[model samples]
Target: MGNSEATLRVDNVTKRFGDFTAVEGLSFDVRAGRVFGFLGPNGAGKTTTIRMIVGITAPDEGKIELFGERMSPKMQDRIGYLPEERGLYKKMKIVDQLRYFAALKDVPQSVADKRIDKWLERMNLAEWKNKKTTDLSKGMQQKIQFISTVLHDPDLLILDEPFSGLDPVNVEFMIDVMSEFKSQDKTIIFSTHLMETAERLCNDILLINKSKKVISGSLREVKASYGKNLIALRAVGGEAMLGDRSLVAKATEHSDEIEIELAENADPQALLKKLIESGANISKFEKVEPSLNDIFIDQIGGVK
Candidate 1:
């Protein structure tokens, strides 16, 4: 993320509906040219926050500024948004639908047509361009909706659960596509509960709980703050390979080995030596770092 380009700022934003407050004092900045992860469990106000940013729902209090200007109707054309729910008309042909959305954004026909074709090719949807959106499979339809969001070449993108139902292969495809968007210096704010994806893709992340930011920072910084070192050990021996569980702090058993969360004072070298001497036939014993899921559980607790 470049500090030079303007940022999208949400200053002390809050939203309410009658008796319920959907988002409260929510604030963050999506810096230009980076993928920012907006993460939380279900009903954590991620959607509400995104809705305000895209101007679909106004905040009850506070402000949203994009490119140093307050968000306004005209700024609609400057952003590309893919909501969590799919909304494209099933009857429209892909090309026609793309052109219609482009026109809605005030894109001229000649340029719209050319850009449509380019995006179709870039997404490998060129052959499906003439087919009706209804004719494609669920995953394929997802691909089309994704194209519709980016067709206008907007500077900022807001994606909600972009990989929800995608298979492993399609998920990989989406990651590759997102990587391309970042290369162009386009800002992307992705909302998802999938920790692994956020762990791999985001340059910065904001984790919310009960409509408040519980954690926000670079991935390295966040994980390092967890204060426990992860270690994975694999050996040929049975449970005895682990020795007395007392020697380790907390251990989780994998199919073939055990993963331990070493206490701060526990010496990893001593543990390794103990395991080797116990006739454990150690194949691998490596210290692992905490995953996003661990940190999430540590901060947000379990689902309600």
Candidate 2:
């Protein structure tokens, strides 16, 4: 049985393409009015799982439920999906394309026109309304695609790699738009390889690797599970001390500071004493909480 509050549920779902397993025993719930992130590295079954959730493809085993019921065509009117692959008609005008998609969702022509105009203006695409979609820049087209997804005002929105091909400014714009949707009590599920974005945007996340789940929980719980084993140091002359394996199991150097993974059972106090004795000028040295990126690298065996 699905949780009454869950907008979508995947129960031990698995998908196989010939002999290769695309997803394995995956189970998670997207609760209503929450921003849920589906995170994974490339080929980590993110897209495959998304396809199954939207009913574009069926899972070989297990069950999927939307709105406390088995997934079916009736749910199509309630879902707005933006695939990773861009699919706008190149030659079609932006307004017409959006209108066509809205109509497909059973929105009336009059209503679609009003919503299209409002969305176009909000997305800063008002001037390009009559222009061919192919003529817009990639970022502009991305905004148009996003507008199309929400034009029908569906209860749930599933976006795959929505930030791809967008500049930083446009990415922020999309983030703001998502925040607005959440404030309006809409449910959202988005898949991304960008851990930073996911960390900032999602209320809950499921991190997968090589077709299997590595972690799934609220962001705070997942990060807290790793404990404070990471040390962030910003120093003028103590970077060389990071090479001492007695203190650090692994060290990653940045332009301004270095992050070190402490050796097992190594006391942080003792490590700080050693760095001081090494004639280093340390500006910042503290046991900092691990970031989602750090946790991901640790769990996945490396950075994506």
lDDT (tens digit, per residue) of candidate 1 on 6-121? 56999999999898888889888888888999999888889899888888888999999998899988898989999999767889888898899899888898999998888788
Best by TM-score: 1
Clashes of 1: 1
In model 2, the worst 10-residue window by lDDT is: 1-10
Q: For each candidate in the order shown, give its overall lDDT on alpha carbons.
A: 0.84, 0.87
> Candidate 2's residue-wise lDDT over 1-304, tens digit each?
2223888889999999999999999999888778998887888999899888888899999999998899887788889899998778999998899989998889999999999989888888899999998799988988998988988898889999999999998899899989988887788998887888988999988999998888998888888787758888887766667777887899888898888889988888987888888888889997887788888888888634
State the TM-score for model 2.
0.81
**Alpha carbon lDDT at 174, candidate 1:** 88
Clashes of each: 1, 0
Tell me the deviation in Å of residue 91 in model 1.
2.3
Give per-model TM-scores.
0.82, 0.81
Q: Of the candidates shown, which would achieve the greatest lDDT relative to the real structure?
A: 2
Q: Which residue pairs in model 1 clash with each other?
A: 230-288
